[model samples]
Target chain A: MIDQTALASAAALLGESWTPWLVVPPGLLLGLIFGAIPGLSVPIAMAVFLPVTVHLDFLSAVLFLTSIFTGGGFGAAIPAVLMNVPGSSSAVATTFDGHPMARQGRHSEALGLALAASCAGSALGYVILLLVVGWVADAVLLLGPLEMFAIAAWGLTLIAVLHEGSFIKALLAGLLGVMIGMIGMSARGDMRGTFDSLALVDGIPVVPALIGLFAASEMFRLMRRDYIVEDKELRRPAFSRILAGVGMALRHPLVVARGGLIGIGVGAIPGVGAAVANLLSYAETKRRAKDPSVFGKGEPRGVIASESANSSSEGGSIATLLALGIPGGSATAVMLGAFAMHNVTGGPRFISENLDLVYAIILGNFVQVVVLAVLGLGFLFFAASLVRVPLRYLIPGVLLLALLGCFSITGDMMGPITMVVFAGLGYWLREHGFPVAAVVIGLLLGPAAESELLRSMQVSGGDPAFLLQRPVATAVLLLLVASLFYPLLRRRRRA
Target chain B: MQGQRGSEVALLLLIAGFAIWLAQDAARRSFSFENLVLMVPVAGLILLLCGILAVAALRRAPQEAGGGLARVLGLLALLGGLVAGLETIGFDAAAFLFLLAATALLGERRPLVLLAYAGIMTFVIIMTLGFMLPYEMPTLLLDPPR
Candidate 1:
C-alpha cells in the first residue's frame, strides 16, 4: 500500500523553503480563531480564504487549507468546554460534558482532554485514510441512494432514542427537525414548505440556527447566574492541571480509539460528517460506561469521546473527497472548489496521477496535529479565563456576537430572525424535555435522507422489493432496529 | 407543575397541527408514491410521534413548580422585537436598544454604564461585521447616501 516514490515526493514538498516554516502555522491559527468563534466554521474560513489561495502553488494552497481543517477540528471544542455553547454542531455532544466540567471547576482539564483526544483522533483518521483509501473507494461505490438513506435514518433514530427525555418526545423532536429541514425546494424542483418567501428558497441557514439553539438559549439560562462557574478557586486555570487533564485523556486509550473509529466510519459518509459522528460516539461511550449517569454531569470520558470522534471525522471526510471527488460536508465542498481552482481533479485519475500529492496532503495533516498541540496550549491559557467573566456582561456580548455572525451568514435580516425564532423555540423545547440535539441532527440529515429516498424510489420504480437488491441498505436497516431496542434491553437487564 | 404540563401539551398540539397542515399541503401537491418530492410520509410520521407524545404526557405524573417562565418569556419578547426592528431601524440602533433592555433586565442598575456598554457593543458589531467583513447588514446610520 505504501508508495515509496509518493512518500519521497511528499517529503520533498515538506522540505520546501516556505511550506513548513511559514504557511501552515498561520493557516492553523486562522482556522482555530475562526472555528472557536460561534457562527464562524471551518468551511466559512476556507471559503473566505479560498480566493487568497489562488496566489499560491497547488501544494501550498492545499497545505494551508488542510491546516485550517486540522486546527478547526479542535478549536470548535473551546466554547463547548467553557460555555454551554457549542461553536458548531460537531461540538454539541462536547457541551454535554465539557460545560459540566467547567461548572465543576475543571474547565482547563476538559480543554486539555479535548485537545489531546483531538490530536490523537486526527492522526488516527489520517492513518486509516492512508491505509484504506483505495479499498474503501470500491466499497463507497456499492453504497447507493437507499444505503445512504438508511444510514441517515439509523443515525437520527439512535440519537433521538438516546435522549434523556421520554422516547415519544425524543422521536417527535427528531421528526419535527426532519420536517423543518425540508423547508426549501425539493430535489425535483417542487417546493415543500417555503411559505412563498424568496429567502426561504435556500432553506434555514443552519449555522445561525445552531448558534441560536445552543448559544443563545444557553446564555438565556445562564443569565440569572453571576458566572459560568461560581467557585472563585475553580476559576483560576493552571498549566499543571491542564497537563494532568492530558494525562487523564491519555489513560483512556480505549475510549479515544473507539471514538476515532466511529468518527472515521460516519465521517466517510457524505453529508453525515463530524456533527453526527461526535453525537453517536458520545452516546456509545455513555451506554458502555459503568457509571452512565455521571455522563452529562462532568465526565472526562465524554469530552474525550466527542472530541476524538469529531476530530477524526476530518480525515474521514477528506478520504471521500480525495478518492471519489465527492465532498462529505461544507468544509470538503470548499476544498473541492480549491481543487478546481488548482486545476487538480480529485477522482481515480487524480489519485493514480498524483499519488504523491495525496501522500503529501496526509503527511501535512499529521504535522498539523503536532503544531496544533503547541498553539492550542497557548490558546487554553486565555480561554480558561472566560469562565470568570460575569454572566450579565457575557450574556449580551455573546448574543451580540452571535447575531452579528448570523447576519454575516445570510447577509440579511433573515439571519437575526432565524436566531431569535430558534432561540425561543430551543428554550421552550429544552424546558419541555425535548432533546434539542435530536432535532438539530434531524434537521442536518433530513435533506440528504429525503433526496436519497426519492432517488431510490425513482431507481426502483416504486417497488418495495427494490430494497432487497441492496444488501448494505438492508444491513443498515437491521442495525437501526437493533439500536432502537438496545436501550430497552439494557434497562430490562439492569432491572 | 401544572403550568409546565399545560405548556408541554400546547407545544405538542402546535406540532401536530403543523404536521396536519404540511400533509394537507402535500396532498394538494399530488401526494403519491410517484411524486418523490411529496414529503407526506415524513409529515405523517411526525403526526404519529406527536400523538404518542400527547398520550405519554397525559399518563405521566407532573411534579415540581418552575419559577423562570416569566423571565424566559420576557427575554424572548425583547429578542423578537430586536429582530423585527433590525431592518427598519438598522442593526446598530436595534442591537443597542436590545442590549440596553437585556442588561437592565439582567439587573445592571447603573444607567450610564448600560448606555456606554450598549453603544460600544453596537458600534463594534457594525464595524466588525459591516465594515471589516463582507457581511451585508442593513445600517441606516452607516450607509452611504442613496
Candidate 2:
C-alpha cells in the first residue's frame, strides 16, 4: 500500500529527529500564530512559503503547507476570543462564541476549546482523506459542467445573500470582483478587458487580489492606532484548562462532527475552497445551534464548530487536488504548481500508482495532530497578548507586510500596484460599510459561472430556456436563487 | 454627501451606463454575452433604490470622521516606502528600514527600542522566509552583504 520509495523519502526529508511529534506541534503553532494575528492571513502565509515547498519532497512539502494551514485556522480564534476581530475569514464563526467567552474573562477556555476542536477536526479530515479518495471519487466524477455551474452559481448567490447589510450592496461588490476577474485572459476568445498590460494577460493572481482586499485594507485601517497588546493573565493557562477544552469538544461531538462534514463536503467541491467552506459551516452552526440566539455575541460552541470544520476541510480539499487534476481551492491550486516543481503528478492515476505517497501525506497529517495539539495550546496562551498589540503599530507593520507580501507573490512591482489600487478601493468601500468578503466570494465564483454559461450557450444553441433545459443546472440555479433570496424574504417578514 | 439619495434614485441610469459599457464592449470585441453581466446594472439599480431608502436611516444616525490628513498622508508615505524601500535597499535592508521608519511615522518614537524591535524582527523574518523557505524578495536590492 505504501510506496517504499516515497515513504523512505518522507521519513528522510522530515528528518530523523523531525518525527511527527516535533513536526506536528510547531507546524500547528506556526499556523496558529499566523491565524491569531489580525491581518496576517493563512493564504498570505502560504504564498510566502510556497517557494520553499519547491525545495522539499512532495509529502514533506504538503505536510509543511498543511501545518501552516492548521496553525492559521486555530489562530483566528485567538483574536476573536480577545480583540473581537477574526484573524481569518474562517475564524468569523469562532467570534460568535469565542468573543463572548473572552468578554466573560474565559478567553483561556475559549482559545483552548477552539484549539481542541480544530485539532479533532483535522484528525477526522485525515481519516477521510486517507480512506475516501479511492472509494468515493468515482461517484463524484458524475458531476458535469452543468452541475459545476449550478454549484458555482449557488455559491455566488449564497455569498451575496449571506453578507451583512444590504443584499444589493453585497451583489454590487460581487459584480465589481467579477469585472476585476474579467480583466485577465479569460477562456473566451476576446482579449476581454486587460487594456494591454502584459501583467493582466494571465488574469489577476488570487493571492494579490486577496492581499489587497484583506491584508492591505487591514493594514491601512490600522495605521494610525497605538495598540497596546495587553499581556496574558500572569496565571498560566493550566493543564486543567486544556482538559476542560477537550471535555467541551467531545461533549459536543455532534457540533464538531457536523462542522467537519461541512469542511469535507466543501473541500470536495471544485472551485469552492476553505474560505467558503468555513463560512457556510459557521452559518450552519448558527442556524442550528441549541441556543441559536446565543450566536454572534460569542458562543464557544460556534467557535468550536467553525474552527473544527475549517481545519478538517483541508485534508478533503487536498485529497481532491491530489486525486483529480481538478483544484478544490486556491491553496490546492498553488500546491499543484508546487507538486509540479517537486516532480509529483497528482491525479487519479498518479494516486493509484503512488498510494504510499498518498498514505504518507495522511500519515504526516496524523503526526501534525500532536504538533497541532501542543501548538494549539501555545497559540491559545499567546492569543490574548497578540490582541493587545496596539492597532497603530500593527497597522503600519501589516501594510508594509501586505505590500511586501504582494511583491513576494511573484517578485514584481505589479503585485504592489494591485495591492495599492485594491486597498484604495477597499478604503472607499469601507467608508460606505460594504463587505469585502462579498467581493472575494464573487470573484472566486465568477469565472466558473461564466464558463458554465458559455457551455449552456453552446449546448442549447441559444435557447431562451437554456439553463432550465437541464435538470441538474436548473436544480443548482434554483438552490442558488433560494439561498440568495431567502434571507431577504425572511428579513422583510421580520420588518 | 447627500447620502447620494439622488445617486440611488439615479441608479437605474448608472446601470444603464454600465449595460451600455459591457454590451458595447462585448460587441466591439465580438465576445459572447453571458446575460449574467446584465445582472450588474439591475442589481445596481436595486442598490440605488436601497441606498435612497437608507439615506433617511443614515441621516438620523451620526457619522464619525474616520481619520485626518496627517494620518492619510502618513499612510500614503508608508505605502510609498513599501514600493521604494524593498526595491532600493532589498528585502532585509528595505524591510528593516520600512518597519523602523513606518512605525516611527505611525507614532512609535523611541529610537533604540524601535530599531531593536525592527532589527530582530527583520532578521527572524529573513532567516525564516529567505533562508529557511527560499522566498523571492527583491534580491536585486538586498543581495548585497547582510
Candidate 3:
C-alpha cells in the first residue's frame, strides 16, 4: 500500500518550498485564536483566511489550511479546560472534566494533557489516513441515510452515559434538547416551534445556543465564587505542572490510541464529525474505566480521551475530503473551496493522478502536529492565567465576549437572543440535577437523526423489514442496544 | 422542600405544555408524513419523560441545598438586558453599561475602578473584535464607516 516513489516525490515537493513552512505558524496561530474564542469556529477562521491562500502555491495553500485545521483542533480545548466554555461543539466533552481540573488549580496540567493528546491524536490520524486513503473513500460510500441515522443514535446514547445524577431528569433534559433541536422548519418545509418568527426559518443557531448553555450558564454559577481557582495559592501558572501533565498523558498511551482510532472511524462519517467523535470517545473511555465514577470530576483521562479524539478527527475528515471530494463538516467544506480555487477537484481520479500531493498533505500535517505542541504550550502558558483573574471581573468580561462572539456568529440579534434564552434554560437544568451535557448531545444529534430517519423512511417506504437488508445499520443498532444494556448487566453480575 | 418541589413541578408542567403545543402545531400544519415523522414521536417521548420526572419529583424527598439564586438571576437579567440593548443602544454603549452594572452586582465597590475597567474593556473588546471580524457590528460610539 505504500507508494515509495510517490512518497519520495511528495518529500521532494515539500522540500522545494519554504513558503509552506512559513505559513504554518501563522495559520496555527490564527486557528488557535479563533478556536479559543467561544463563538468563533474553525470553519469561520478558515473561511476568513481562504481568500489570502490565493496568493500562495497549491502546496503552500493546502499546508496553511491544514495547519489551521490542526491548530483549531487543539485550540478549542483551551476554553473548555479553563472556563467550561467549549469553543466549539467538538470541545464539549473536553469541558466534562477539564473545567473541574481547572477549578482544582490543575489548569496548567489539564492544558498540557490536552496539548499532548491532541498532538498524538493528530499524528495517529494522519498515519492511519496515509495507510487507508486509497480505500477509505469507497468504505465511506457504504454509509447511507439509515447508517448515518444509526450513527447519530449512537451519539445520542451519550445522554445515557453522561447520567450521574437523576437518570430520569437527564433523559428529560435530553428529550427537551431533542425537541428544541427539532424546532423550526422541517425537511418538508413544515414549521413546528418557530413561534412564527422569520429567523426560525433556518433553525436555532447551534453554536450560539452552545455558548449560552455551557459558557453563559457556567458564568452565572461562577458568580458565587471570587475567582476561577478557589485556592489563591494554586492560581499561579506553572510550566512544570504543564510538563508533568504531558508526562501524565504519555503514561496513558492506550487511552490516547483508543481515542484516536475511534476518532478516525467516527470522523470518517459525514455530518458526524469531531463533535460526536470526542463524545463517543469520552463515553467509551468512561464506560471502560475501572472507576467510572471519577469521570466528570477532573479525571485526567477524560481530557485525554476528548482532546485526542477531536484532534485526530481532523485527519479522518481530511481523508474523506481528499478521497471523495466530499466535505465532512463545515471546516472541511471551506477546505473544499480552497481546492476549487486551486483548480484541483478532490476525488479518486484526482487522488490516483496526484498520489504524491496527497502524501505530501498528510506528511505536512505530521509536521504540523509537532509545531502545534510547541505553539500550544506557549499558548497555554498565557491562557492559564485565566484562573488568577477574579470571577467578578472575569465573569462580565467573558460573558460580554461571548455575547459579542454570538453576535458575530448570527450577524443579527438572533445569536445573542438564543444564547441568553438557553443560558436561562441551561442554568435551570444544571440546578435541577439535570445534565446539561445530555441536553447538548440531544441538540447536536437530534436534527441529523431526524433528517436521516426521514430519508431512510422515504427510501424504504416505511417498511420495518427494510432494516433486514441493511446489515450495517442493523449491526450499529445492535451495538447501541448492547452499549446501553452493558452497564446494567455488569452491575447485576457484580451484585 | 415544598417550594423546591413546586418549582420542579412547574418546570415539568412547562415542558409538558411545550411538547403538547409542538405536537398540536405539527399536526395542524397538515399531518404530512414529513412534518409528523420526527415531531410526533419526539413530542410524545418528551411528554412521557415529563410524566416520569414529575411523578418522581413528587415521590422523592428534597435533599439538595440551594444558594446563589439571587446572583444567578441578577446576572441572567443583566445578560438579557445586554442583548436587548445591543441593537437599540449599539454594542459599545450596551457592553460598557453591562460591564459596569454587572461588576457592581458582583460586588465591585470602587466607583473609579468600575468606570475605568468597564470603559477600557468596552473600547478594547469592541475595537479589537471589530478589527478582526469581517461583518459589521453596530456600535453607538465606535461604529466605523464601511
lDDT tens string, model 3, B78-105?
9999999987888899999999999999
lDDT measured at residue A157 in model 1 versus the true structure, 0 to 100? 65
Candidate lDDT values, in order: 0.82, 0.64, 0.90
By DockQ, the best candidate is: 3
By TM-score: ranked, best first = 3, 1, 2
lDDT at B19, model 1: 78
lDDT of 3 by residue, A319-410 (tens): 99999999999999999999999999999998899999999999999999999999889988999998888889989998998888888888
Largest lDDT belongs to which candidate? 3
Quality class of the docking in candidate 3, CAPRI style: medium
Q: Please write out the lDDT profile of model 2 over residues A24-139, one tens digit for every residue.
A: 55556567666765545666667667777676666667787878776776777676566555665566556556766765556667777887888888888777666676753664
Which regions of candidate 2 are displaced past 4 Å? Answer: A1-110, A219-225, A228-251, A289-295, A325-364, A460-495, B1-28, B35-73, B88-97, B126-129, B132-146
Ten contiguous residues with the weakest lDDT in model 2 chain A:
A226-235
Candidate 1 CAPRI-style tier = medium
Interface RMSD of each: 2.0, 4.6, 1.3
**Model 1 residue B140 distance off true place after TM-score fit, in angstroms:** 4.3
Report the TM-score of candidate 3, chain A only.
0.98
TM-score of chain B of 3: 0.88
Cα lDDT tens digits for candidate 2, B1-146: 34433333344344335444644454456534553343344345445645554555455544444555366556666676767766666778777876787777677789897998778777766555554333456553234222
